[model samples]
Target: MQEYPNYQDIVLVGGGHTHAIVLQMWAMNPLPGARLTLVSPQVQTAYSGMLPGLVAGHYRLDETHIDLVRLCRAAGARFVQACAHHIDPLKRRVSLLGRPDLEYDILSLDVGATPARDLPGSELAIPIKPIGHFHRYWLQLQKRVQKTRAPMKLGVVGGGAGGCELAMAMAHALEEQVYSGRVQIHLIHAGDKVPEGYPLLARRLVARELEKLGVSLHRHWPVAAITEQGVRSASGATLALDQVLLCTNACAPPWLAAAGLALDTQGFVLVDEQLRAQGCDNVFAAGDVASFAAHPLPKAGVYAVRQGPVLFHNLRAALTGSAPKSFRPQKHFLSLLSCGDKRAVAVRNGVAAVGGALWRWKNHIDRGFMRRFSELPIAMDETPAKRPREIVAARGGVSLSAMRCNGCGAKVGAEVLHRALEKLPAQQSAYLLRGAGDDAAVMELPQGKLLVQSSDQLRAPVGDPWLFGRLAALHALSDLFAMHARPVTAQALVTLPLATAEITQRDLQQLLAGAVYELNRHQCALSGGHTAEGAEMQLGLTVNGLADPDQLLEKSGARAGDCLILSKPLGIGTILAAEGMGEAQGRWLQKAVEAMLQSNAAAADLFAQHGARALTDITGFGLLGHLLEMLDGGEQLGAALIAEQLPLIPGAAQCVERGWLSSLQPQNAAAYAYVDNPQEWQKLPQWELLADPQTCGGLLAAVPAEYAENCLQALRQAGCTQAAIIGVVTGAERPLAPVHLLRKADWRELIAREAETVQS
Candidate 1:
């Protein structure tokens, strides 16, 4: 994925099938000088076609969910994991939850509809509009069935095809998975047929299948109200069921109704043949979120999947002033509804069939469709980007782009810098003599205390400037935390790519807001520092703190019996590297982001309170590099670690095995010189993780043996969930190799190995 000079923006506002396919297509044929972004509440989008199979235990999670993070990376798009709360067509901006509004040149909406909540007590009933939320509830239901240790009654509302399939699948799950309990599943419909729009033959076949599977059919029963016990029909007949799965008619999300777009009676966006929102040329819509006004089609996954290519082409056309293409849905398409047990009922053009063969065919088609996103082809265009299209005009023919001059000429405009400074997150400190806008910050030194200071810098890794700012500040603050100091004041040094005055101000404001948030967490005040235009985004922080001489910690005081504890899990570096290459899954990247944003203050304080012998924060050189530095504090003290005891980030092992690593990994390998039998150890994923570079990594401490367990409990209670005891300090047995890396899963085995090594 190459970055070009961006002039126009194309924003996709969902991870639905249509947008997923569009991303896949864009990867193969992207427009130059256009910026792309995706705003989605989820990292993975469920494939509705195979959702029933997934619920029935025939398909796994990965098979039915598409990784939006990977697709965005492949398409050179910025992935924003946040829900869109409002869209302003007139202003050309979309407001997201807890973030700045995103401006767009062209926007498209494919966010699927939620189940209509028309009647009272609908909130009590479990709506299956969002499949992701429904899946979690399903897992809980399975456990509830087993926990009760008795027969249960489950009901599915809506006699539509989705409801019918889900009812049968629920019955099958009870029979196949849970041995301790049985479930009596019921399907309720107000209509004459289980599937409303299908052929008569197809309806008859589906009814027979439901009967054979022992699903109770409540025909002509429209739900009037829901109660604590169960569902009540319009005729006042109530079914006292344990739970209800609502698969009623689709309705637009509440926010969409106020988006100022033309909508149908159901509140869904109205679109013409080209899928462009009516009266809004810059806006487009597809999938369940859009109601085709010319020819109203049923909300089905097949139509959304088919409409993807046309939508993709038209979006590009809109950007380049080319003629747009129109999408025409077929009058009738084949429908394959999964049965509970490896069988499916197929309907097409007044013909219907039921057999196990249909299920196999459906599975093959669904997998093939998924492979388009899972296995993206390699591209040959690795050329360096030409200067981006100008969003702001250049001054005197001097192009202001990724390439800018060095020295004072590259300084940001005074007006842009002033506006950016005024909007920074609130900061206050009594010791600061001057704040931002000064030549340099003047700060009073901490009186009658040991002054602690540290500095750290890194090239921005994540796409979001705000997030990168937050992570960078926390990374720099960890050094002060590890020393058991109270952070007081800090200065920010930022290097951003050259852009227009307005764009620079916006970027700088977001970045500083995030940085100040982290600084404020430690009661640190933001002073002033340098800002310059550069080829890329980067942040550096210089922090000043005060420490009590008696409580101050260093990496040099560990004894032979001290225990080594890590504040967080390893393997974050690998996941980030894989995401950059478009090979990492969405869930994997989410976990990495969460880990990097965590503050180390809590864990450091806990270690200090528990009488930690030595402490250091791990960073670019990896765990082993920092660990070696910690060892330098003592006299030839050796360390022993259990390989399997080291915690790993999700997907880290798979990524490392596939050769996904940060560019700094090779340089960090210099720490491997301390490992015994380096050639043999290098074969394991753990070996690479030991040398993997982390951005906002965690604190590594050596605590006394008696205090290790209590310290761990305190850390977790304070939200250091991944904190654990990984290794222990020991006598200097091997002068050549002081670190003993053993492949043992148990603590006793590690102790036994140390004993044996000492005796030998």
Candidate 2:
């Protein structure tokens, strides 16, 4: 809890349970002058303990997860959802899979361990240790079981705890179905005992559970090779399995070994008592992925959770000028395990027992752990910490706390941008009124008396040029839909990270092609713009559309008593922020990206037909931030939103509950300072997600109250799955910063019903 005097950056590289706890501690007692950043590939971190429950249909996806985005946001850290591909120790940079390299003064890694797959033909095998991916595969197995009623044999490699759990869970799930007896379960381990590493009593308990599930167990056998048909054991025994799962012997990520870090013989990062890399003080490692020379511990969630407090302290100490603290890992921690049939067993200090109450206890503990991430409250520290020395040096001590002015200030620094744009020429247009000076250039209309225009830009957090181009193009077009302007012509401004000419060309082509695709979808002409190599990646656009002046849509057109409609769900901002940090889940990330890539043209079309009054796409700013713009344009107005009614991308609210939020989330929350009780806002996980800034987000349009239902129906029919009638505009209820906030129960019920209907 001690505050450091100098600003330093602590970059955590996973969204594991340990890091989630670390974030919570940091939120309560922040290290002054330190900027915390989390990198992960998922916005939602699955709780391993609940995997069995989830498989058994006892727990929901939202029940057993951590919101990496919300956790980072609550901790006042930047969350980047990106996978770590390599680490440059000399450069102090962590290079991502296909994004920009991240610079950190001090780094802590808790990315967890994966099952070893170095055996021949391992690619044909399934890994059960990565619970989330395995969960999806398990779902496929269910479908396969149903499709083929013939006898099917399931093989599990590695008699460890994970393998035992999966075998039991699979047996329970498959047996409950009509094809129960047709499904055969086999458990193979290199050792004689099931759950070999646990105490004798615990091992015996698991064995009994497997016996009751009618699972066949093989001992002292290792797989020599895995094939499409089956696996070959070293003992010269061949086992035919319809599905084979491997869940033994955890190994550090391959990238870590290639990154040149000092590792153990097994390839885990070697760390000292304080979790600092054995030979590198600036880098630290932990979880199942790390090996400690002084105190080696098994890869267990309990150990990871216990290490959090010590890791947080040591990380700050390493950045500032302080001695490292020792992390004394316990010799034995309690292990509460499930048997996939509402039954459980507890293993602690060599004692073991099983009972129904034990399962309840386990569920309580897991839910409690998840609740920490799901029910976080937001309270910003008024006194901002000073900038880090590196950032100060980069900025020459210039102020950077506030947003830069738009017109000239938003432009790149004079010397830097001038040289880049010099090679590019302005477009020659007879109707061009202005080129590049004011907020946006003025362009006269054609004979039809209608004009179409759009603008967009992206500050790169992660990902490569190709993906960035597509995202930028989609973002730029949001404005055209907001104004209900017809797509006609478009241009782009691309800024790329410095690289060779070959890289530049590839970047430009992909970037523009992405823009071109969207423009062409609307039949708009891709005229031209500007491109330049720079220190980082940024893309923007100035688009033009055509419409009668009288038909032009504006934020000022919202009227009192109108219904507030949101065309898409919130949470992309938080998810992307988490993705940059490498804490986001791979599946959740795919979903977020898909959502961002979708254009709002369909929703806009539906809203226009529904008597849309005013509209603006929610971006950079959050829901309340954008809503205020609509309400305050003329006479003051208030809004009563059904907190549950607001449409949100799946898992976003859970991320908020876990305290995962965008870097802009706190800022958006600050803009919500007008709200009297922010705690009330915290109850609505989705409402808290409203502060999550979106990339290519949907339009927030005001529609006539009379046509609200019809508008909603039209939107649904037009394929706007997330569209919803969130609330109604109200007269101003006294002057306050929060002119709008959520009404929890109503919103929650509506959304729950919406989810069920969609599922049905």
Candidate 3:
């Protein structure tokens, strides 16, 4: 009888070719009860095969790139856009650049090797291993070539296949652009031959290709250092060149060797025939980043690609408590290399060089491989309804959708939270008129100045501590700014997760650094607060701000006909939710994080300068919910919102389409039911997206109709480009129309009126 595969998680740590194959295979024939995840720094993975062709101006960037976002979506794998810092074999976790530890039952490492060998000033020199960086550098070089009409001297380090190809490609490119045979290209190598490890015939073909491209080759010469002049060899010989490209022997990222995993002499992970890292049953590694201890082979893409299936099967075997299948790597594999200008060189066993037709054949293979990722679209197969027994069992636990508690219970669910906030009553003082409850509570001044106090807490559901800290500081300061008060002092509340003493200290230092950086930027003096131990990390701030009685903008001053303006785009909550599930794109998520970190200090300053009547920052409560609160407190004013004019972050509509909403979305949407056309309003994507909750979000204010444009202009100059007039205030009626929803036509008219008024 076959053993049933138990539920397990198989995490692929990189978006290399091997992992791409793994994702495709997993999508086609998924292993029962196995959860798959792919983690990388970017959503797009460039096909190395088409990279040379791209540089030669044959293929467009998108044409030569595999969309990891689309591929992972198709595979039903969690795709996290983050850089891996290290692995903790003992803890069965992989640490990330800007997020929490990702635990794995079975981990596969297919992260390709980087060019990090011992070359002096290597940090200053560019490494060709990170193709993303190389692409940017190459573009810069092309612009330089176009701008500088003088003869150019370029140097290529390493006589390896990659180095040779880039040298010829650069030379060919420069020749096309400059029309000057004055461009000189030099290839420097520590080895005696161009393809030192390959058969001599293969070397001759590559040598011929290099000569054809007019690349001068220097063999048996090692570079000791790279300088502005050029590469300096160990024998004290320096090759002069204007630009240097380093494509030396590929070495594993040094951070990997220190990750508590068994490593070979060259610092690659030591794996058995089964691709399992030595002495670590749950851990596995592959590609150029891994070395077979028993039968070590050269770092090559073919081996990495071959290991994917074996790795997949072994992972399933490990999950189901069965014996793992071994991967016996072949003694030799076909090597198809690209020469500059759409030509190629193929080497098989003892046989050697072939071009033209062979290059076409290689091109077919490369395009075919890329099509697996690019051509296929993700179609999520409907999950079969859970059986009665499983459904019953799932209902017994605390619901993931349970109503959140306030104060301490207001914290995120324990399972999801990095750390819990400690609940403590504010310290009592005679001078303290109010503590942490109200938005900018009143406080007795030390002298003639009046003080306002407010506080806020944030539980990070996703992303890193530094990012969380930045958002936390901004969130805390929003209360002061919303009250038209200048921030003066702040005290931090920190709750750290379970970790080693040293790690805890480092986390605290980093978290504080992030917070201090934001606080200092706004000139808020750092005061003392509290810290404690918890299962998850959290941050909060208790802040004091100063305001004169006459200039203060409370939440209660809106008059009838005041224009309602929102000083930032909506959908942060949707983005945050997507980020938690690893469903967000890297660039979009980066923008959201940047927006969250931005201080409303500047916007508030402009609001005070421009004579705002009333203000409130949009936070956990949706925009509609916050607007309702302002309506209740303001001067018997009702609101009529122009749904069409609302600003939103990109991808927010898709998030809503996919049912990715903030946990608080339901409550916020319910709050909008008071409006007559709430359902009709919900039909509009922007209005529907407005129900998304935000953390450290933008401000909403009631300004005079005449001054609204000036206020918006002030906001733009103050760095609030997303700011817009969203609605207008109205006199409260007997039926109590506190909020009115405008139809699409009316919304368009409101926006036009605002634009025309601004232009006039």
Candidate 4:
């Protein structure tokens, strides 16, 4: 049976703690007619409650973060990995950084706050509010501290609990390291005491913990300027520090005011007791980014977590024409502050208690909260309700079943496909020979030029039809480029899911518009092919090009000493799989998509100019799979791949470690036996990624060692920044396997020698 289309949309702007809860709730009890969408820049959002624990090394990154990608999948929401650049309340549209505007019948915002950077020299200091950015910086700082022989000074600015907790955790972490004695931490705050706003007893307990940890506290120190040298106080006292971490007052994103919404003086979205935007009936705000005008609350994680159920209920009510429920937050909530050394202080209503038991209790509460999202229930595949007898009869009594197949399973009706093609623009090139309305395209070959043909097909990997079409077209053309061919003509093969004539026609038009856009860019004309009905969407293109017979590149042409070059980064396969399972960040998926859509024509031309001996595009088989194909029958010829030199797509390695991979991964990985050191390579988390399948992937070219650097430089100049000489073809003598995966150190001397020769 055909699934009913979603008629209304509910868009969530950020994957904050509240929205994570909403997604969990929605997954369990979804509103039938509403389609949910989440727009966020990250794949995983850090849980503020676990920040200190993560810093203290009590938990891993994945354990302390919510996998927004996977959560969105479980919630059946369209997860767009992009930042909201602007929101037009009047038009009900939210503009994103690099995608189309999203229209919403109901909208919710839970974008958390960032640390205020108003102080002079704040630019040089790392702000800890945007936890994602801070986490990355913290890792790099940790590595720097561990490697330095000289004494290292770290300063934390802000007397609040967040700042204090971070200082203690950082000190605890450094103290556990091998060179812990050389690292010193200083807590600087404008207030006279640390843990400001907490109960007196809580403050005393925190001060004692700081003293025990050898953390020096600088009170009543109003920082006037920050420089690379250190922090400067208004009283002319300067503290020299190698690194400065800011955990100051919260600041709202400036975009809220620019969206024309009523906002508080501090730039937070103004909301009423019902959590609805002050002036916009269809909009709602929650969490730290929102300021409740009736009863302003501290920007804390507890408040955000409590607002989750209220926001979920109000958003659904606002969409369903029901009265919104008012949210009354408790005046005082229990606060547990960790002391970074397996101890914690609990405070409420001016009373306080401290002990190791309190720390254990805090850990249980935080982990229990994380378990809610981390151990989410697997969402069952929903079956569409059966249509009435009369309705089924009108459609010729077709069988009704909810299960739908993907790939060829989602092709459009042949009749519908034909009608759509009849309306497309007619082909205008002489090489077309025969165009649309034909079973298959037949193009005339240019005089004295060799014919080059390549075909590629794939199930829809993205939700946007138009964008998917462009990517599919670009992917199909990559093979021709690998063979050093110039585009001439192309044929389209499209499959679409069951839908009404109007929708089918519209989707077909949009899909072709994207494909034709890319084809036109390469001076290729679309002749025609076939279309059919299926259970899911799929697109394919059979592209033909012209090339000089003698100049064409082949996969079997590699010589023994040629340097191997990869035109794009590895990990698209793993990233796509992670995204499908909702474990990848939106920014990572966006970057992968952009990389997939990039044309390989320029890289191919550069490789050919530099005399590439052998070339092939890395696709379904992956880098190793395609490389093995190049080595198949060549006697005594093997390749050495520097594991570290391989350019990786950002976030790919993390996804692999989390066990997210393509369905074809097992089959691709079976080829790992061809590597010399299988056991050692397999132990690395990034090893499985080598076998992960790719779509519209990069070109793998083997060029003379002398010209490899020039080819790589030209590729980068043409926009292939990740291109690199990953390895080189080796002589037959060292043949335990067809491939050798070596560490970077093992090949550094060889690479240096090659670099000198290239310069000569």
> Each prediction's TM-score against the native?
0.92, 0.63, 0.67, 0.77
Show how many residue pairs clash in every candidate, following the order shown: 3, 53, 5, 16
Candidate 2 local distance difference test against the native: 0.72
lDDT of 2 by residue, 350-456 (tens): 89999789999998888887777756644233134533443344335532333324443343344444443332323344555654433445566788676665677
User: How far off is residue 532 in model 3, in Å?
Assistant: 23
Worst 10 residues of 2 by lDDT: 1-10
The whole-model lDDT of each prediction reads 0.83, 0.72, 0.72, 0.81
Residue 647 lDDT, candidate 1, scale 0-100: 82
Better of 2 and 3 by TM-score: 3
Q: Which candidate is the best by TM-score?
A: 1
Model 2 alpha-carbon drift over 4 Å, by segment: 1-6, 177-180, 379-594, 599-760
Model 4 lDDT vs. the true structure?
0.81
Candidate 4 Cα misplacement greater than 4 A, ranges: 147-153, 176-184, 232-242, 379-455, 463-470, 486-534, 541-551, 554-599, 621-692, 702-760
Better of 3 and 4 by TM-score: 4
Candidate 1 vs candidate 4, TM-score winner: 1
